[model samples]
Target: MTAAPAFPPLVEAYLADLEHALAASEPRERAETLAAVREHAAESLALHGSDDAGARRVLDELGPVDAIAAASTPAAPAAAGAPAAPAATPAADVWLVVLAVASLALFVVPLVAAAAVIWAVVRLRAGVGNRRVQTLALAVGTVSLVGAAALYVSHVLAG
Candidate 1:
């Protein structure tokens, strides 16, 4: 009625530009393809409340016709022989693995082994390194250190 845009020249021009740009698409698909674009422009107009400047801004954001057409086209495939490289293990993890193995000497070197176990527990809780390997290291160190402590406690009680 009186509130409507009977002469929405900018909107008409934008749609015409979009149609020309979409010439590469199949004739049957052109209408369906532009459905989303039309909906967006309508929504923009509604939000801006019949303002022509808002309509112009939305059309500007859609950019030139050629660019829109190019964007809709599929990208070219990657060239052959481009395999990705494997990730390297962290230095801290390597040290943790070594210490976990050494922690088996709990009886001969309780303090160092106990320290190693504590380090492993901290690392394990913090989710450091590869899970399976860190878990194995933690298990080995924890059991040996606990055994060492149990033996020391029993020896003191027996005396």
Candidate 2:
């Protein structure tokens, strides 16, 4: 096996700080910020002479960890404007009901539907609204239900 490339101490510290900052950020912004940090580190390593002092200097120039985290995070809307109204609780309940109906349809359908509904509800409760999660749940539930129906029909035909 090839030997792993070693990072200088300062470079390692910078990377650790970057990781912490990325972890504290929202999921939506994480990818882009991570890419930027990775690119910057690569560029810095390439330009700097291979010396600990050089790495330290580069990291120091990059500034503090908190500043980096703040810069990477998306700014929340200013409170000057009227606050947006909360989403209707009943809508989420409706989604849960639909999920329940889909789950009752067949074998694996209920399991998949229940998982999706549970995941969406948990995310919503945690103040995360992901349209992708909702869409995935709906699609998976429908497909499973349809598959279950088709299997039942085939069995009847065979009988």
Candidate 3:
């Protein structure tokens, strides 16, 4: 039998999409899906007996890459089953106000308070679920820190 021609590009693209979908999926689920995809691709290629046609068929069976990625991801947890939490409040606004007040008093206490604000901002940015609030807090905290530093420098220069 004549050897089938190589379809490197098509195969590579298919593999890339598969990998992307895997990455977006949960760790345990990703492993299973990856194994299934590998096996399916191999089987299709063997059955088709031509690399180009095999790759095309495999990709068609897999469906859209984005759809696969979305499917593999876990759904966001619903609030119904959990305890009744308080309604969502603008916590970031409150935090910004607190930080601003703290910043003014920080001048007498030196950088300690300013450092605390910076630390809180970093923690918020890292762990907070609300991206908008995290970003606002970070911006306000950063500005406060910079202002505090400038005040300290000016104080020393004047004295």
Top TM-score prediction, candidate number: 1
lDDT (Cα, 0-100) at 121 in candidate 1: 76
Tens-digit lDDT track of model 1 for 16-99: 888888776755566666776777777777777546787787777667767767666532335467774655766776777778
How far is each candidate from the true structure, as Cα RMSD in Å?
11.9, 12.6, 11.2
Candidate 2's residue-wise lDDT over 1-159, tens digit each?
955345677777777877777675766687777667656665676688548876776677677777888876654545668797766544554565466456656444446555655655565567555555455555655566566667778889999
- Full-model lDDT for every candidate: 0.70, 0.64, 0.64
Find the number of clashing residue pairs for candidate 3.
Answer: 0
**Candidate 1: lDDT over CA atoms?**
0.70
What is the Cα root-mean-square deviation between model 1 and the actual structure?
A: 11.9
TM-score of each: 0.41, 0.39, 0.40
lDDT of 3 by residue, 1-159 (tens): 955334447766776777876674677887777667666766777777546777788778867767766778663346667876664646654665566557555645546445546656666656654545555555555666677778878989999
How displaced is residue 67 in candidate 2, in Å? 0.4
Winning candidate number (lDDT): 1
